[model samples]
Target: MQKISTCLWFENQAEEAAKFYVSVFGDSRILDVSRFGEGGPGQAGQVITVEFEIEGRKFMALNGGAPANFTEAVSFVVDCSDQAEVDRYWSALTDGGAESMCGWLKDRYGVSWQIVPSVLGSLIGGPDPEGAQRAMQAMLGMQKLDIAALQTAYDG
Candidate 1:
């Protein structure tokens, strides 16, 4: 078992969200699920917790109900090898969610995600400070990162 797995709190969509996430990521699976007990806080037989993994990273979803909600404070970052990968994740994640600047998005379940190109770090933190600034400016103008545009900006 991996130590220090992330746990997400949901109103009651733990299982549903887990299934959706498993479908989105190319490498992911549902490890296990635990249902509520007769005297538990949640409805009996309802999903209490869902254990899953995405690209080998472990996560748990809890049906904590009301009060507990998702915010932009925390988000999952997906590193894409190219524009295709970025497009895929961006489309999947933003189907029923809102888009934010700089490749950030809120999924249907209100979870924030960052769909970033693998080269983003190098482009934005490269040795050439001017190129890095250009890349940063390009990224700031996009919702879903355009890898080609970023590359152009970096090369400028």
Candidate 2:
């Protein structure tokens, strides 16, 4: 078991969210699911918690009550190898969701995710700071990250 796993609070969509997430990331799978007990906070026999993993990172989704609060203060950053990977995640996560600027998206379950290219880190920390700045500026105008466009800006 992971010493510390990230827990996500959902409005009774823990199982659904876990299934959706596992479908998107090939290396992910649902480990276990715990249902609510009789007279528990949630409906009896309903999913209360789901343990899942994506790329070996453990996560727990809790089917808490109504969603009172969820903020962008915390987000999952997906390191994509290329534009195809980025697009795949962005499309899957943003389905029936809202798109935010600079590759940020709020999934249907109200979880914020950042689908960023792996090369983006190196570009931002590269020797050419000016180029990186331009790339960042270009990225700010995009909903889904475009690796080719970012690369163009970096090369310019």
Which candidate has the top score in TM-score? 1
RMSD of each candidate relative to the true structure:
1.3, 1.6
TM-score (C-alpha, index-matched) for candidate 2: 0.91
Model 2 lDDT vs. the true structure?
Answer: 0.88
Clashing pairs in 2: none
lDDT of 1 by residue, 66-136 (tens): 75878989999888999999999999999899999999999999999999899999999999999999999
Kindly report which residue stretches of model 2 are placed more than 4 angstroms away from their true locations once superposed: 39-41
Model 2, position 89, has a per-residue lDDT of: 92
